[model samples]
Target: MSKRDFYEVLGVGRDAGERDIKKAYKRLAMKYHPDRNPGDDTAADKFKEVKTAYEILTDPQKKAAYDQYGHAAFEQGGMGGGGGFGGGADFSDIFGDVFGDIFGGGGRRGGGQHRAQRGADLRYNMELTLEEAVRGCTKEIRVPTLVNCDTCEGSGAKKGSSPTTCGTCHGAGQVQMRQGFFAVQQTCPHCHGRGKIITDPCGKCHGQGRVQETKTLSVKIPAGVDTGDRIRLTGEGEAGEFGAPAGDLYVQVHVQKHAIFERDGNNLYCEVPVSFTMAALGGEVEVPTLDGRVSLKVPTETQTGRMFRMRGKGVKSVRGGAVGDLICKLVVETPVNLSSRQKELLQEFESTLAGSDAKKHKPRSEGFFDGVKKFFDDLTG
Candidate 1:
């Protein structure tokens, strides 16, 4: 039987470009593939015909010759037989080109050499006192991690020998499996995707290219760094396999709780105790700050839980914003363990406000009773 025109077999015009031809061929080939239409000889023959047409048109030299001379250029009297032309080229080459990107095997047709993989990143948690976080300090930390082997220089081979490409994958690190006309790639079993095998292992790292060791590093803490802040140390993580680039090490900051102060954002809060006499008389009381003790003026008749702001007395932010304020909450303390003479003097002072003037001395107590009387009056009347 005279075969159909190559362009007609792929359902593309003769004037179609290579891209358009390939696109049409892929659509028709998938539709009439033998696996999709089993037990149909007509479809099977059609698949072979489509495959033959695609191979000829895609080849530069064959396409040129076929364009000028038609099928006569590949006739028995001319260019051998067109039936064997389909087997000359590997079908996997086309399969990889069409579906390689979806399957992650593009640009890796044959067993090519594999590149070294990068190392894993590491995290180190460091605890710092609130004072150290506010003032900024440097500390030395010891970390246990994998480092490149010194004896073998991370090659994983003995001093006299070297690693060899994997026999199964030929250094590709992946093996291609054939399922019918489909090719699937997976990590090579022999070398476990390392692409190289060490026949004679290194004495120090046991052919692993890395050794477990303790590393001591100094990390500088910036001022006003709060909890959850991370400092990155470049190329300080575990050594990469086969001497690839090392990963980074992250220093996670965790500020310890302070004894006298509580931090909210960049601000500091603390409670200061003042004598009731000093609160009522309006005197200067000493308050502790981060830098030093500062004098804070307590107003006359100052109540407990009244906040006093000390500007620029809190921590400076690490991100370089305005310095925060220190808020001091005052608590009036009552005198305790009074001597006999002192207790008598306090009783004398209390007797001065015992009558109708007691309301003027304790307004909060009078207001509490007024509210209580109103609540009971509403319940009864």
Candidate 2:
């Protein structure tokens, strides 16, 4: 019988791109794999046929020759038959492209199958005072993580003994099983895919290669660092198993609430309370800031809820820019617990001013009443 077209076997067009070819192969391989299909000889044979088709189509020279002369190019005594392409040709090159990485063979031959994997990253939450967040400070934090054991130097074996190659896989880290015409690769169960086993376990770490420990590290916080900012400490996280590269430590910042000031981006907002007398007759009052208390002038006739801006009084950004301003909202506080004499004096002052058109003195109140009257009239109508 004549061989089928490679593209037709993989269910792809002849002009299919490399990605499309790979995706088609992966889907077919997964579906027809012996382990998945179980005892189905037809699926196994189809799997092998697709694998072989993919191998021929993906190679530049083989694809070119096959395109020129069809199946005759790879036949028994054809042009490519005798020179390195005959019956003794190794199929591992094609197998590596398809199943090597998935089965833990490191994708290709002579690439040295396994090395230590990088450690997991860690996060540490740190609380900072508003003042400290604005000014920036260095803090030492203690983080619990896995560190390599010193006894066997991360080898996970006893001092005198070393790890041995796995007997089940013979140090290949993977095993191949023939089901019908198809070859399936899987990780070695004996070594748990590591290809090596420690016969003499380390007493200190119990052959785990790492130990639980607390590491104290200093992190420098930049100025203007707000809540939700992170400082990364490279190579400060958990130690990798078997002496792999260590991961990073991230310090997540949380700024504590300030009693006097609230921050919005680079700007600072604060409510400054002044006596009613000070609001009526201008005076200098002290206001609190991140740095220290500063004097702010309350202008005469300053209304309640009026905002005053002080340039360069807010935080300097951690990302670097011009310093922000401090916005102080003035709130007039009425005098309480007045003495009898003071009350009498205020009553006399009120009596003198009473007949002189209260609407002129309280224009906002008059305007509010006018608006209420108009709303009632509209509702009635």
Candidate RMSDs in Å, in order, are 15.4, 12.2
Candidate 2: segments with Cα more than 4 A from true spot: 1-112, 378-381
Q: For residues 151-254, could you state the per-residue lDDT of candidate 2 as single tens digits?
A: 98888998888889999888877677665444567667787667799999999999988999998888998889999999889999889978889899999999
Least accurate stretch of 10 residues (summed lDDT) in model 2?
83-92
* Candidate 1 per-residue lDDT over residues 286-328, each given as its tens digit: 8888899999999999989999999999989999999999999
Clashing pairs in 1: none
Error of 1 at 102 (Å): 9.7
Report the number of the highest-lDDT candidate: 1
| C-alpha lDDT of all candidate models, in order | 0.84, 0.81
Q: How many backbone clashes does candidate 1 have?
A: 0
What lDDT does model 1 reach?
A: 0.84
Query: Mind sharing the TM-score for model 1?
Result: 0.71
